[model samples]
Target: MEIIPKLDDRLKDSLYIQLYRYFKHEIEQFTFETGMRLPSIRYLADRLNVSNTTVQMAYQQLLAEGYIESRARSGYFIAELDSDFIESTVTPCTKLSSEDSSEQKEKHILYDFFMSDIDTDHFPLASWRKYANKLLNSEHKDVLKYGEYQGELGLRKALSDYLHRSRGVHCTPEQVVIASGTQSILHILYQLIRWKNKRLAMEDPGYQGVRRSLQGQDIKLVPIPVEKDGLSIREFKKVQADAVYITPSHQYPLGMVMPIAKRIQLLAWANEQESWIIEDDYDGEFRYRGKPIPSLQGIDEHSRVIYIGTFSKSLMPAIRVSYMVLPPALLETYKHLEWGQTASRLHQQTLTLFIENGEWEQHIRKMRTLYKKKQAVLLETIKSVMGEHVHVSGQNAGLHIVLHVKSNCPADTLIACAEKAGIKVYGTSSYLNQNKTSCSLPILLGFGGLSLNDIKQGIKLLHKAWLPYYKSSEQCSVTP
Candidate 1:
């Protein structure tokens, strides 16, 4: 029997991914029994009206993930899977009630433009696996033991060197603290800084995850408005904040790179007030417009900046590696505290090797190029498809751009319409701390996880979905 996948070109996922999912589903459901031979790449390509390379990629993915195996001079065959694994992995089908069915239909999103997503298809799996396997050897058994409370020394050293070379950050290996994620690092930072008044000023309409994290600690969060350049310094001075959190490299959700003049002024304020600046430089590696902006911590003459960087965007998020550079003041405080290691010692060791061998920088350059192209495609597609129906902002940097939809409907209504059309777009309303009505119907479209074709198709579908509500500025007033 021949296996055929029903591939839809209009869907967000590429043809190879769709084909892989189809086969994986079939195999999990036992439709493709153990030892059953799959159709040849050429045969399947011709039958499915896709390229042979696409079929080969799908088969390779299945083989790598252990869904199938290939014999020399023979076609692919289904791999024998453990019964318990299958039972746990596959959800049992159940007849849904009317309400459940409606809910499921509403949640069915074909294309997702999540701001935090990254391109997993382009991850350096082979390079990562090589280093991981090397660290798993008997000679490297020390990696399996409990690591330092601060983090792996080797990784910290590697990161210190990298930050200095790329972002102009000034820090020693002793100041570097590795954690599982940015939130984990933030929690630790809070502990170190909790001795002071717990008032922290953050960007208004900023990253909600960080806002929620700080709020959970009962820290007073003052929302400073973000202007066309970045955080408004004039408003920030009004609040008696103990510390300020800002994404200066590329502001989260808004994608504004804070100007150098503002950066100097903020640092001056921190120095004069004896306050701290928590700079979360997430996705600082993918600037598309002009020369790459040096980090906020780079310009700190007073050492008031606590710099945080993560590999979740540059590499895949599953790696779960984020590091922060503590100021000498905070570093001393952190040393006195009792905290266990959060990141995996083994994974940290592997990453250290990956970086030391120069693969980390190499990977960044490759991804920077790839993301630039994806961003360009997304912008061109929006202009061609959406035209004057939307006004795009935050386009020159980061993985996402903001689209202020010229429609009378609210952001939620536009999101619902897009959802109904099987497209997923995010809103900026949740980013605001209090002023929900301040923002217009602005939608965020992330291009990092999407293919070039997916971006085009998604924008076209979005235009068609919101066509009914499209109105001119003269006809209806909409604030961006």
Candidate 2:
């Protein structure tokens, strides 16, 4: 059996990627049917006129990613298609997204609601105007030249002070490196940990974007379940991962805080396993009730934690400014890796002045009040609409709340019906980790950027869409 290879001039992907795709495309098209064996690396290499290394890399990547698993000395064969599990449990999100799907299509539409952001209107635009103008007129003369690899010095220094004081993050300016956002931080993180041959323990029913960012990478992810108290410490220990990515302040989707006990236990587990703890602290800035819980990094006696903080959630998601508060040993190694200024000199300077001039503090205080009011309205709205037909999870804090449906309604069906009715809702399946319950039913609805009126109307629309499946007394009883 021989296969001839052809090259496309327009295929900008790596040669190995092209080879990988060539085989995958054929397999997906069923040109290579079930029980078919894939060509050998050396044979494919000779036919394609590419190096053996390229063919080997392509096959190795596929094997590692579970696209094709190799049997001992039996050569490679098409993986058994677990159609039921694969179709229901896996993401509809392909690396290269399909335009035909409702999610992708709705994203392109004007009223789509996959938005993960806070109200920018609450920002002190006047202060930013002053700083922005100052940068344009004066700061640019010096900063206009190419800047530091981590970020502009002024911004880093300001952020260093702000994070330490405001968020209980433990880091010096030297330990901090600014990047575009969380994904940028994850990329650097992926590079650091990939060489260690360690599995990454990710929070189940967590952030889809983070999951997607690390998908198909060399690192294997052990998706640990998050319980009421926080991540199940027992499950965490079982994973024995190189690093654990957590949103302890308010666990994403669930809104559950990692209690102090669990926090201490998590750090101890990290120490025992010789692993790292990545504290995302994603949306810690705006807690509606109770005293501020200290960051997991602040209490760390051992330097096992890598603290990540972002300005996106508090101010605006477009801020695109996040920093990694590194451990001392890794700090020096990261210093030399800094290349082109990922953060603009002007953008940095403007952010710096905002933090320095007491603008950010005031802005956050106002936003906290505004978002608290919004949260109250959302609770009331959902209660009025869904009533006994639903239960709200993770509502103590954060900009979003997960509303769990109590009826026999499939989460996917509810989402589809909502979309058809011009309402947007994200199902629990979107955030499930491996080993997660496939039957979990919840919709994560964000409220920080929306007004009370919008919340009321949105809930009304959602209730209308939900009425079909949840109409019977068996599904829901009218609240007195």
Candidate 3:
């Protein structure tokens, strides 16, 4: 059968992705049975009125993802995915009770404000390819062998220098341990500290990923309330915690940068209580305000802080590289632990070259400018359209900003309404560790993956979606 997929040029998703999704959905639904032959690329391109190259690209992606396979003389065939396996691995979407087909119509989201996504358009692909090729061309024995368990020495040295200069972190190459990502690094650190029975303090409306990882390790988590400044140190003192996890540079989801005074106070607490502070400076490099804030680790003179940094936000997430700066005390513990190499030596070598040659710095500078403009547009559009009906925060840094909706509607209701209008906004309640908070119902709007035009249009559509609720409130005020 000839497959004719609907294609939209206005959408942010590329044609290849759209076609891939169509074929995948069809296969999943069993419309295309296993071993069914797919149409030739040129034939499908003609049927769908798309380019032959686009069809080939989509097919290649499907083949790579194991959704389809190719044989000699045959174009492509659907892979045999076991029904039981699919049912077990694939999560089912929550079905709506209402008879309205609105939920069905809301299948495609044109503007996705997903937080933690970086703009793939701005990534230094050309520079990265050049560096990767250069490293592969050289007959260096280092790339072929297993790197040091902690990571490549050259990459760690380069990272140490960059961290000291950019983030004001003081550390040597010996203190850095590179891992796959934040979760992996945290796993190693948790094992080294052995703080299982001890309570670990975290922000109330904090990063869910961090909280989940700690909980999985059987660590007792104490949720501390966060204010406009940062996490409440007063609440922290009340708990008998041995270690605390904080995103001091730019608080996740809420976007509060801890001031120097607060940083000093936290350090003093760590010193006095003989506790350790886990500082996650995830996106500290993208501060749009005056100067990037100095890292909390930089101020801890007592060596009571364990600094964690990731390249997921700054570079592409696919790189999967993160590093932790261990204090002198724990550095020995890490050395004795049975740990194997986590990050690929090839990637580590390329990253080291990228940093040593200053390309990484250049990329950061360029992205900072681009993200600042996108953020400004998102804020300006929201203020102009929503007016005082919404309160925006966390615009100082990072990829996302929080919108405190001033309506009586629940956070999920607003999110659903926006979804119906083809805009995706995330609820903040799920991020709360203790489910109870006095803060207004907030929704996170991420602009890192969107363009300036899309940001403006998305905010406008959101305002339109929420207009009726505020309009009714205004009408009631005048009538009463």
Candidate 4:
């Protein structure tokens, strides 16, 4: 059958892609019947006044997508697709407006307080570019090759030294398994321990990213309550979990550091139970009050802790470099399993150079100072503008703070109001696995990415948006 696709040169889409879409739509509509022969690439190219490569590329795409099949001598023919398959692949034209509207709404947002955002303006771009370019030279073309299974050796060695000096983490280069991000590292750890560790206990209001990752692995998750000092050691002692995940350096959302006594107690419990502990020290470098607490792995003599660290907060999130220090037993298991590296080799080399040149520590020092100032401004503005109506916590460490708003409105309602007024705030309810109803309304506002002026103005705007629901102490008594 002759196939003629109307090609447009003025449109943004290339001629091949447009032609591919046209043939795809026609095949889905059954305009091209099952087993019907498509026009030859040369004939179609000549008829459509396009190059043979364009027609060949379009046919190749269709063939790859199962819409067409190519025979050795029969050229291309429409595949026999079922009705259900065709219906599922069809896209309705009505979705365009909703997608466009969503994009427009995002454009209107003046301030976004995303918890994962880092201060991109302060990133050491020049230094990073210098290192990246150095690696891109002809002499360093070996970066294009596959990296070590555990990760690049030099990067792991650098990470080990940096972790020891900065966080007091005890490990050698061999124990470090670098991956693309925290979730990927967690997935690898789960594979190594899944046979023995069937039940995992996590904090009640913990990092949901880890929770979701574990949930997918078919392991039962037990939510232990988080106390003022961190995860409740008393409650943790009662559970028969094979492993426990904790953010002890600075508790997530609540912003409370785990005391040294509790850390030792928790370590003793793990030692006694012969269980494992996964310590995620995310954003451990930034501490505004008192001296920084040593990492849990530093104090553990039992070798039961799996220490996870990331450069996303310290340097820049775009680098996508995160590593985990595995205990000797897990490292043995990982060696037997033989997994390929997931992180980019080029990035790994660049990071290695950045650390070796003493730039990584230097950058962290700069960022910590800058973030301290931003957090101070954020806290001051919240107090001055919201006054007695808002109670803030999770300060002095990390990029974000949690606000317990004293109002009749729920956390979701407050977030919606903030968005409508061109500000973005996050809700904390999703982080809790249980006991959500007993807690007060908590909103998370990150000040890392926002400017000092934007921080003050955003809080003022948020207060104005929430003014209608704000009540005096006597009128509302919501406990945080």
TM per prediction: 0.77, 0.74, 0.77, 0.77
What's the true lDDT of residue 264 in model 2? 91
**Candidate 1 — worst ten consecutive residues by lDDT sum?**
87-96
lDDT tens digits, residue span 1-480, model 4? 656666789989999999999888666545566898888989888888999999999888998999999988988889998645654574322122454346436646888998889989988899999999988975866789998999999998999998999899999999999999898888888789963438888987888878766665668888899887889888988888888999998787777888899999889988998989999998999888977889999999999999999988888778888999999988888998787888899999999999999998988899889999999999999988888888887786899988888866567666765665678899878888864532265888888999999999888877765655555468666554
* lDDT per residue (tens digit) for residues 1-480 in model 3: 848667897899999999998887566545476899999999888888889999999999999978899999877999987645454433323223463246535457878999988999988888899999999899776688888999999999999999999988999999999999898898898789997677888888887877766666768888899998899988888887889999998898799888888889899999999889999999998898866678888878899999999999898788999999999999888999959978889999999999999999999999989999999999899889888777788888999998887765567766776776678999888888656433256889989999989998888878765654442346334311
lDDT of 2: 0.73
All candidates: CA RMSD (Å) = 14.4, 17.7, 14.0, 17.2
Candidates, ranked, lDDT: 1, 3, 4, 2
Score each candidate by Cα lDDT. 0.84, 0.73, 0.83, 0.83
Q: If both were scored by lDDT, which would come out higher, candidate 2 or candidate 4? A: 4
Q: Residue 376: error of model 1 in Å?
A: 0.7
Cα error of candidate 3 at position 444, Å? 0.3
What is the C-alpha lDDT profile of model 1 across 126-226, one tens digit per residue? Answer: 99989988888658567778999999999999999999999999999999999999988888888888734478889988888677566657678889999
- How much lDDT does candidate 4 score? 0.83
- Global lDDT of model 1: 0.84
